[model samples]
Target: MTDTTTARKPPTSKNSEVHVKKRRLPDETGIFIVLVAVLLVFSILSPNFRTIDNGFTLLVNGTVIGFLALGQTFVLLTGGIDLSTGANIAMSGVLVALVMQAGVPWPAAMLIALIAATSLGVLNGLLIHYVRIPPFIATFSTQGVALAIPLIITGANSIQVRDIGFSWIGQGRIAGVPLPVLLLLVAAVIAGLWLRMTRQGVHVYALGGNKNAARLAGVNIARTTILVYAISGFCGGMGGMIVTSRLMVGFPATGTGNELFYSIAAAVVGGISLFGGVGTVLGAMIGAVLIAAVSNGMNVLSVQSYWQSLVIGVIILVGVSFDTLRRSRAGRPVFAKRPAVDTPSLPPSTTPSKS
Candidate 1:
């Protein structure tokens, strides 16, 4: 005779197995692919769009937007926006020219203008952090001030830049590449590295991700806010300088055009979420290139300016709408959710019967 016995197996714990999700490609990847596709399409559509010279022109034209978008990336990462960027450009350009016209060296004038523009950024920070003002109200109020200051100072007239050396910033080329494009590339690399490698950069992300959580994590909210806005201001100053240099004149109307829209659109399109805490500088740069290409391509095809504006407007809506949808669903699937790692089920175990 034999007795049969069976042993029951213990329940498997969910924590026993680790689910390491596959590494995601950088957020910039999709945008980069899109950019490549755009370039290809435009190249096919117009022979003018395929020329190396036109390629350089695209980069040169996009430089100002790229600079503004870089700064906007920092600000957006902190869940803030600066509508004053365009105005800051006008202000800094006018101030630098006015200073140079007043017998100051161009370099010195540029420095002063940068300082002034940066100070405005600091003001935005102070108001938002200490004064308890909303980012929109704060930046919009300052935008009006910035726009008016340049107009008021210049008496609504353009200021001529007599210093030929200053033109190098915008017009000069090295190794056949435009100076502005090179400067933008260098700045983008540094900005990307800083965001990925620095402590403050992490804080910027944390703040944007969840402000109260970031605060509890010992992130200095005030400083991060101020720093981002200040960066935005500095970028604006750089844009102003480049444009002023290119034109050899500081016009109050310089950045008052579609620049502000293009920069914001570029930032959002490049993968910087409008809801914040989800973007990269590299992505923003890609977006800038895409925007520049679209604009340039339109011009190559002789599309009207109004049509260009309409296309940009549509792009902005699409980008922001997608961002908003993502934020609303946070960690859940909206359009396409973050890919999930499948956890395999464990088979049941049993002891052999004794006979």
Candidate 2:
């Protein structure tokens, strides 16, 4: 009698094994290189883009997006997103301008706008945390409300800002640096430090990483959620102030434009994961600068606005895909997997022949 086995194993040959190349550089390194390459390419293609003044213009123009992306980084770190930020810009911009026109002092009006925006964020938090509404739906609903508020109040007309001091916020320079740019830098620095060194920041990360685990570890879910959204709102309000200051006008349609989309794209492109809990302020800011550069370069080259949108959309797709792949490969072994080879077993001999 003979025994036989039916098991077969995958081949162990080098060809049979899949090979995943080791990452030669950190994730941020690739995006940083891409940014440099983009700058170089545009500088080579457009002489106008190589000028110092144009560089400053790009930085100024990116301020709103940078602010939105900065706030976005906070919400994303907590595994949430705030779609209402763009609308917050519209709401706050129009609100500030309207109140200023209504005899409120410019400084006071600015305070009111920031408060309104923060209140909007708080509403979103309450809905998401208390009512159990999903972050997406809650923010989307708030976005609509915010978008409509400015239009209803202004009748879709642009409000002219008469306060010259307001211009200082957007147009003034300190040591040849635009105030808005400087403001964004200061905010980014503070945000980065808070996230790295603060206990609350750790709570935000834990919440995003795993809600249950974080809860078990005593993270205050409601406070973290509300706080992140509120911070996002504050950032949105700052963006609103800058927009209003820059043009000396509050356009209701400003928020309805590509600002929201670009802000999200900047965060993702900068390496903020769509799934959350895995990104940095520096990366997001770099992503913002990259998007700004692309936008400025396109304008310099006279590329159509629609084409710019297409390029940004492509960037978003690529960034999300990269993030997804990274997550999937998180725990994978360093080398490609291989299995031992197996040979078939012989059948048993006939008992009659043996007898």
Candidate 3:
């Protein structure tokens, strides 16, 4: 007689090995495609759109907005918004003009303007981080204050810039490229590299991704917040200076409403998430280019200004909607429909008879 015995293996837990299928992260490919499409459409619609002079005009017009957008990207990545950027530009221009008129050297005046603008940014950060004010409300209040300072200082008047040296920053060209455009490119490159290649940049993304988690992970939230806003102010101030240089005048209302709208639009359209923690400076620059292209194309086509505004509004809505969708999808599991694989069972064993 022989006896047969078999041992069964215990079933593995479903959670024992989580096979998470890796999905590609959302990128700025959609925006880039839109940009290319817009370019092609405009080129086909208007014969003058491809001309060099028109191209220069588009780039020049885009410079100020590009600078503001760059700064906006930094703030947005930190899960914050700055409505005061335009005011900073206005205030900085006004202050620089007033200082220059008072016999200060152009360089010194520019420095003072930058310092003032950066100070306002610092104030915004302090208000948001230390005082616990909401980013929107805080920046909005600061915008009013910033705009008022310029209005009060210049009595809502324009100050003509006679200093030729200062004007060169906006109008001069190096190797056939406009100075302002070149500056924008340099700044964009620096910002993009910093965001992609540095530890601080990672912290900004991490902070925006989850504030509490970032805090637990040792991110210096307060400093990062302050730096973010300060950079915005600095960029705004630089933009104001460039505008003043280009126009040969510094008006109390230089940037006005256009500043806030265009800057935010550029960043948003460039694929920066309003909810924060996702975007690139290069993308923001491309967004600025797209905006400039649209405006230029509309002008060439003789479209009404009001219609242009409507179009811009539509673009913003579309960009934001896309961002929302991308974010939502990113949050969902990639293997939601993955098929289960059954664990193999052990075969029964036949024992030899002990006869």
Candidate 4:
């Protein structure tokens, strides 16, 4: 006290105390809440909406496109689009149906059908990865091809599958759960685990976040891109098989307008950004189920079919808008900007902080 000595404090490092708050996981939470709200509303409006029969029907019908959305999730994770999913489904359905009629065993028929579908997917991948074509153009071109192939094979007709064994896989229930739904659930679990806990999953997100950075990080961008599309094709094939079993027929018209619903709805509502780099498999499944629920509810309520389409379109817009907003916020990091390079020169020692 008598000497009036003061100790100087060392400068604090800005990096040590970042004070960043944890962010909420994508808009999927909101979608889930909305789904619950929708179900409640529909149940209140139409008592039939809560019926067990309606529930089972919804599960069966939703399984086909639900699986397609799983593939869409993969493609979108790699910042890619697959416009041919619907067409792929149609082609697979027709192929399987026609093959089953040719005295081929059901399992063998499915193998051939899946191979054909994967080939189409491989073509898309090659065009996008090797030929350097934009994914949009590549998939769209393949979409036309997918649509044409089924027509060519079936001559614009439907091929019915009378095989009871094959039909059971599509419609059978185990402990009251439809087989298709069970398959979808299993696929979801596998896809979710792959994306969340595997190296390839990390690579997919990294590539979507920044392709150059991902490549620099030793991620095989081209291969991942190719694989994502191939996976999408495989999902379509599986969905097609389910559809064939459900109807006991495979028509060239199978899955028409489905690509629009599965891709747009699942990707957007599941928090899979259009700009890429974000999504979850569980979220995609939830999104698909929500859309399916809405459609089913509308049917129960006797709402016009066109009105349902309009509602779905609006939901798509809302989802895409939310995704864009979330991505923008996520990219705005606390330390995103560089510090100022030129600090003002201090005046010749303002009393030099004497000790």
Alpha-carbon TM-score of each model against the true structure: 0.85, 0.84, 0.84, 0.84
* Alpha-carbon runs more than 4 Å astray in model 2: 1-26, 316-355
RMSD of 4: 9.2
Clash counts for the predictions, in order? 0, 0, 0, 0
User: Which candidate, 2 or 3, has the higher lDDT?
Assistant: 2
Ten contiguous residues minimizing lDDT sum, candidate 4: 334-343
lDDT of each: 0.85, 0.85, 0.85, 0.80
| Ten contiguous residues minimizing lDDT sum, candidate 2 | 334-343
C-alpha positional error of residue 10 in candidate 1 after TM-score superposition, expressed in Å:
27
Q: Is candidate 1 or candidate 3 better by lDDT?
A: 1
Q: For residue 265, give model 3's deviation from the true position in Å.
A: 1.2
Q: Which portions of model 4 miss their true places by more than 4 Å? A: 1-20, 23-27, 318-355
Candidate 3 displacement at residue 352 in angstroms? 53
TM-score of 1: 0.85
Model 2 lDDT tens row, 79-170: 78999999999999999999999988899999999999999999999999999999999999999999998999899999999988888888
For residues 148-190, what per-residue lDDT tens digits would candidate 4 score against the true structure? 9889877798988877789887989999899899999999999
TM-score for candidate 2, please give it: 0.84
